[model samples]
Target: MSKSVRLLNGSSLCSGRLEVKSDQTWSSVCEADFDQQDAEVVCRELGCGPPSVLQGALYGEGEAPMWTKEFQCGGHESALLDCRSSDSDRNTCSSGRAAGLTCSDPVRLVGGASRCAGRLEMKLGEWTPVDGYRWTLETAAVICEHLNCGSAVSVGKRKEASRRSVWSIESDCIQSGSLLRECATPDHGDSILNLACSVPNCRWRC
Candidate 1:
C-alpha cells in the first residue's frame, strides 16, 4: 500500500503523473491498476479539486519503479494511503502506461471572453470574486498555473460601483506557496482582480 503520494511532470501542482511512496521508495502507478475512485483519493489527499482527466502518459512515463499492485479505493478516503491494495501477477508494464491525472482548480476566471481571462474568483463554501487591491503579477501567476493557463499576461482591477463581498487574499500568504483557498478571508471590497492568461497548447480550454 502507498504511504504517501505526489504528482510529477505536469503543468501545475494539481496535475501530473501519479507517484506513491512505499518502503521509503517512490513508485509509479500503472494505468491499468488505477481507476476513477483511486484518482479521487489522490486529488483529495493533495487538497485539490475533483479529477478532470485521467489518462496514460498524459504527462510522461516516470522513471520510478512500478507499483505492481492495484489500488482499491472506496472514493471517500481522505488520503491515498488509507486505501487497500492487492498484488498484481503481471510483472512487466509498458512504457507510456503510467497513470496521469489532472484535478480541477478550486478557483476560476469569469465574466470574460475566455476561460483564461476574466475576474478572479474562488470557491470556498460558495463562489466569490477576489479583492485585487494590491495584487501583483507574481500572485496572479499562481492562479494561472493552477488553472493550467500558460502564464500571467497581465493583471488588472475591476471597480464595482458599490462595496461588495469578495475574497481578500493575503498576497504574502500566496507568495509563500499556500493555496488560494487557504489564503483568502471574507471581506467587502469594490475592486475585483482581473487577469488574462496566455493560452499555450489550449488543451484545457473548451
Candidate 2:
C-alpha cells in the first residue's frame, strides 16, 4: 500500500485504475461524473502530473466495494480528499464503471512577478527552467489557456535571464498542446520569459 491514493495494477507509477482506501479497505472509484477535473485531482494526490486521458473502466472492471462518491476538484486542489465536494455513500455507484487515467509530465512557470507571468518551468523527475526562444503571442495563448485566463493579452520578454535557468526548450510549440510538458526538446539554456495573461476568473488558477 502506498502512503496515499495509488493506481492499482497500473502500467507505470503514473497510470492506472483509480483507487482509494476507506475504513482500512481499498476500493475502486465509480466513474460517475468523472472527468478531466476529477483526474487532475487524482494526479495531484499521487504527485504524478497533469492528466492525458480518462478511459472509462478501460483498464478493467474493479472488484466489490466501489467508491461511488463524486469528487469535485477545482484543478488546483492538492489532493482528491481535499476536493471542494464529495459524497461517501456507495449506494449511488453503479456496477461496470470504474475510472482510469493516463498522465504525462507536469509543467509550471515561476520567478515572474505573478502566477501567469514567469520563467517557464517543468517537472521531469525534478523542477527545471525552460529556455525562452521563438516565443510569440501563440506561446502566451497556450499558457493563458492553462491558467483558464481565456488567452494571452501580452508577452513581456525579460531582458536578463532568470536565476538558475538551466533548461532550454527546442520544439515546434504553436499553441497546440494541452500541457506545456507536451513540448519536445531536451537541452538546457538560460533565458527568461516574462508574460501577462488576461481572462475572466483567471486569478483562480493563476
What overall lDDT goes with each candidate model? Answer: 0.86, 0.66
For each candidate, give its TM-score against the true structure. Answer: 0.66, 0.51
Model 2 over residues 95-181: C-alpha lDDT tens digits?
A: 557888876546665776667666666776688766666777776676666555576777655555435544554434434442344
Would you give me the overall lDDT of model 2?
0.66
Point out where model 2 deviates above 4 Å.
86-92, 107-206
Which window of ten consecutive residues has the lowest lDDT sum in model 2?
170-179
Which candidate should be chosen as best, given lDDT against the real structure?
Answer: 1
lDDT of 1 by residue, 64-173 (tens): 99988889999999888789888655597888899999987678899988898999988766788999899888888888887788789999998899999999999898
Residue 194 in model 1: lDDT: 96
